[model samples]
Target: MSKKFLDDAYNLNSSQETQDLYQDWAASYDDEVAENGYATPRRVAAALWAHLPEPQTPILDYGCGTGLSGLALHETGFRALDGMDPTPKMLEGAQAKGVYRNLKGFDIDDPAPLQNGAYSVIAAIGVIGTGAAPPETFDLLMKALPKSGILAFSFNDHTLDDPAFTSRLTDWVDTGAARILFRESGPHLPRQNLNSDVILLEKA
Candidate 1:
């Protein structure tokens, strides 16, 4: 896909609209991603696993589209996995794999469904920068982690370069909301965007 197409994918007016679009596209979602080499999901899952304190800990996979990230985490030894995505069709695809113990719809904007300090590890792969959820959702997700909990997430190169977005993220790190574990920038998977960053954050 061209940069314009990738960029336009995230131009939704609201998160709800994005979910609806994904629900409509769920049937062909895997095929569509296969064409892109599944860059964001694969890279984000790898980066997350690499910095985890315990590879076998239970994890919550946010925006777990078609269970790609969930499958990657399971392959890395995370056996206890739960998935949350707003699109039910996507969750159905994930469910068919029988990898997640629990799969449910989630709204990143409202963190009420998740218990505080619940997950040892949390992942938001391929959800950011695509109008999948807002950056403020990060704060909500962070609050769901205990002190020193691990978080693995990815963002597109363009999103990383956004001054306002990066500023907000940096402020969280500065205030000890989350501590940086690792930040890697390179080709995502095989045939997607040129360069994206996978960041590992630890709840502080």
Candidate 2:
């Protein structure tokens, strides 16, 4: 990924902006990230597997983004996945992979019930902290998860510097709604010299 692309991702201010950004980049998005050595998707899948290894476990790949994360999940032996993304083009790309049980094109801000709160696991992957998914994305996801539902996600270095993101995570733990199962900083993209922290949370 180019510096401009990375910067644009973090600086987005609205869902429309995020949708437009992905619409423009959807074609090259997968290859671009791969060329940059994107590892977060695989890492996110691995983290989720640690807590919920059952292949039959239902999963919601929130902000799935061209289905790369969903594919990662399938590759790791989790197949029962439903994906949702804000960008139609991106979601289309994901659909072609034929891995998800369902692929819906809707922004996180949209007023729609996701799986009617039935998912055992929700993988946000590279969604939160970045401007791609708004801060409220967390609350929305938590609402969709029943007690004991796990969330797997990641935060790049730029997002880690933002106290708003980190503080909200602490609040999740402090409020006794969730417990941290895994968190560790690791390579994000070697070419970009960036690193991110992978996190796993189990809702209480």
Q: Which candidate gets the maximum lDDT versus the true structure? A: 2
lDDT scores in order: 0.76, 0.83
Candidate 1 lDDT, 72-190, residue by residue in tens: 88877778899998788999999987889999986644657678877878898877664567777677678888988877888776677766557756888998787888888877535
Give the CA lDDT, 0 to 100, for residue 10 in model 2.
Answer: 70
Best by TM-score: 2
TM-score for predicted model 1 compared with the true structure: 0.87
In the predicted model 1, the residue pairs found to clash are none
lDDT of 2: 0.83
TM-score against truth, every candidate? 0.87, 0.92
